[model samples]
Target: MTLLSTLNDDMKQAMKAKEKDVLQVIRMIKASLQNEQIKLGRELTEEEDLTILAREMKQRRDSLAEFEKAHRDDLVEKVKIEIAIVERYLPAQLTEDEIRQIVLQAIEQTNATSSQSFGPVMGLVMPKVKGKADGALVNAVVKELLNNL
Candidate 1:
């Protein structure tokens, strides 16, 4: 099933179950997707859907970090839950080791040996790991591997 259909079904279930948190998160995601669809003036492709979902995940993570720094335990916990819910829609995430391997291959493919080549290496790796891994994590791995070269 497409992401929208899955979200709709899950939303209905959440409503019947009276799951306030889940329902809220699902609505937020649906709103984001619908807004993007309207802006693009067409149905979103699977990749576009994934991209929007990933963006949602990133925004939540950023909020989580800010909440942590502000010492707001209540907001921190709620954002964490939201992050978990957002994760449910994303592809299975890559392990650090798996991401390392992927980055290594990308470096090899691009013949990138230093931080100077960071752009090319990142360009090569991001598409391969897109929506499957966090961009920040992949970037850190790339930097560590390349700097050691």
Candidate 2:
């Protein structure tokens, strides 16, 4: 099933189960998906849906960080639960080693010998890593590789 269909089914199950937290999270996801469809004036492809899910996951991670810094353990726990719910729909994420391997390959393919070539390598890398890797991780890897060059 498409992500949308699976989400819809989960929404129904949440409603029946009277799980407020899960239902609320699912509603926010549905709203985000709907907003994207409205913004583009067309249905979303699976890749587009994955992009939206990733964006949502990123937002939750940012919020979690802020909550932690503020010493709001209660809020931090809540956000962690939300993050878990959001992750259910996303594809399996790449391990650090896997991402580094891909970055090395991209660098090789793009002949990225220095910082100047980082952009070119990233352009070739992001699409291949999308949904499976985090941007911050990739950026850090690329920076480290470029710095050593």
Q: Would you list the C-alpha lDDT of every candidate in the order shown?
A: 0.93, 0.91
Model 2 lDDT tens row, 1-149:
87778999999999999999899999999999999999999999989998999999999999999999999999999999999999999899999888888889988998887899988989988998888888999899888987888
TM-score of 1: 0.97
- Residue 10, candidate 1: alpha-carbon lDDT: 96
lDDT of 1 at 119: 95
Report the Cα lDDT for residue 76, model 1: 96
Say what the RMSD of model 1 is: 0.8
Q: How much does each candidate deviate from the true structure in C-alpha RMSD?
A: 0.8, 0.9
TM-score of 2: 0.96
